[model samples]
Target: MLSNRQLLVLQVIIDEFIHTAQPIGSRAISKKDEVSFSSATIRNEMADLEEMGFIEKTHSSSGRVPSEKGYRFYVDHLLSPFRLSNTDVDIISDAFAKGMIEFEQVVQKSAKVLSDLTNYTSIILGPEVFDTKLKQLQIISLSNQTAVAILVTNTGHVEHRSFSVPANIQSSDLEKLVNILNDRLVGVPIVQLHEKLSDELTHLLHKYTSDFDAAYHYLKGALFDQQSVQLYVGGKTNILMQPEFKDVEKIRSLYSIIEQEEEMAELLRSNKDGMNIMIGHENKIDAMQDCSLITATYSLGDQQMGTIALLGPTRMEYSRVISLVNMLSKQLTNTFHSWY
Candidate 1:
């Protein structure tokens, strides 16, 4: 319901605050070439905007700062479509130009590219397990009582877990179990591994070893127990550079949340396709109240494979970051599609 002048004034305040991270005064808005209003007229608009909850006055200064509501309105209405700088496009293109044959390599590199380009922490959720097929499963025994289970996907991603060998299962039993799983479970989608093991392989495993029950138990504990999605994080320390994160307790909480891979993966997966933005208190997570998160998905054909996200203070460079994320996501989709 804001008039054209009020909208312009709000946009000016937000843009200025984003750039300088300082409360903006009406005199400053008047000084801008895009603003034709005089200082007195602009001050009147600021007062109305503050009354409407779009802007707030800081205790320390007469100047105003954009409230969370102000940021939301700016993103939803005043944001102009932005084109990625040539340097940004080239950086992304060059990063992907190298031959990256594995999914891990591509995802890890993408994470780094985003963090480096934006100077913000970047997170990427690897392709969901349901979409990936098993390429190999191997068990390497460290001792008679302990061993490690390795799961390899067709995309060249590897996961390993250590477990105590069941008392009834010998090294020979482990070998036989691995052979049977490789024969029957290779090429099976990861999401179906448990079902395939129960319905299809139980009898086959019994046929190969007398310790079939122990082997089945071991397999469940070692391999299927791992998380269904993998999280890749770049520039974990980059958030420290933002002025808003100077509070030690806030940084500690944010870092703790970031380290929880399962929680973060779930959060990223919940995002709908295309680009979405959450600013300040709009984010559900308590620790992210002072930040903004921009997320986009990369896909193979129609199926979404993973997510790309950037995290920074709410005073983020929205236009530039939005453009960068959109371009990077498209590049990722093309790269993945080319691989398939």
Candidate 2:
């Protein structure tokens, strides 16, 4: 166990290293004046810290940097709950108030804004399709043989897919079909109720033998689109600016993984509810070995929600990001209430 003074020294060193992104020396802590410890004492404590894997000496410079273990310990033990100012709240609130903002747009803007504020590459994960609520689902016939399935969320965002139908079906019949589906499924989470629809389908729409197959296929497609959470990443260019990612090979591999929509969609799909934090090596993806994700669920109730996650380097300021993500999700639920 580290002594009280030693622990305090570790905290100070980590804070100083985070700000400067450089190895700190005993003389530096000694010169702080505020630290109150003599250079010899601080140096001894730092040496003990290094032996315990909390800090590392990189060269003959007599300076040290916080090891990954040190960062982990600091985050878990030393960090306190962060408090935001009215100004901070207002900044996030304005991002929510932008009119008719599609979920994708909101997510993209958030990443851009966060990266701009923090000077780090940022990521935001959109709502997962599994938790998407069935707010406004409409079937509009484009031709006798095709129709469009347009869906609107309580968030005023819309998404649609074109579905081909039997030519024998009438527009009136399609409208009736849509009404039946909407009446039985509206406000219900599509994914939760999706798999149980087998028994309910043939019996419910037995009237239209010519249309049953097309309807089932269309509805099935809608229900299983669980990978629908669109991710919006910004500041890929900015990641290139970070000294840690300066290695060209590291940058190439990292960018490749981030650019893969399938992998990102899979990440959001797994966050079923509530806030989740994944630190280094905690994530399943090998490519994400050096990154961390701070995520929260925005739910109307227990049944429906979307995930909002921030992706950044593993050395991210977790306290601030966690607070920001939590507050942003709360605002999302509050803003969506009026539409519901």
Question: TM-score for all predictions?
Answer: 0.95, 0.81
Task: Pick the lDDT winner.
Answer: 1
Q: Against the hidden true structure, what lDDT does model 2 obtain?
A: 0.72
Compose the digit string of candidate 1's lDDT tens values, residues 202-311.
88888888787788888887877666667889999999988778999999999999998888888898898889999998788999899999999888545647899999
The window of 10 residues in a row where model 1 has the poorest summed lDDT is 297-306
Q: Give the TM-score of candidate 1.
A: 0.95
Per-residue lDDT of model 2, residues 1-340, tens digit only: 8798888888878888777768899888877756887888998899899999998998756688887788778878888899977887878878877874466666666777666656666666655555666677788888877778777764555777887766666677677767777777777665655654676655676675457776666567644543454667767787776656777887788889878878876777687578777766777887667777777877654455666677667667777877887887787677666545
Task: List residue ranges in candidate 1 displaced over 4 A.
Answer: 300-304
lDDT score of residue 120 within candidate 1: 94
lDDT, each prediction = 0.88, 0.72
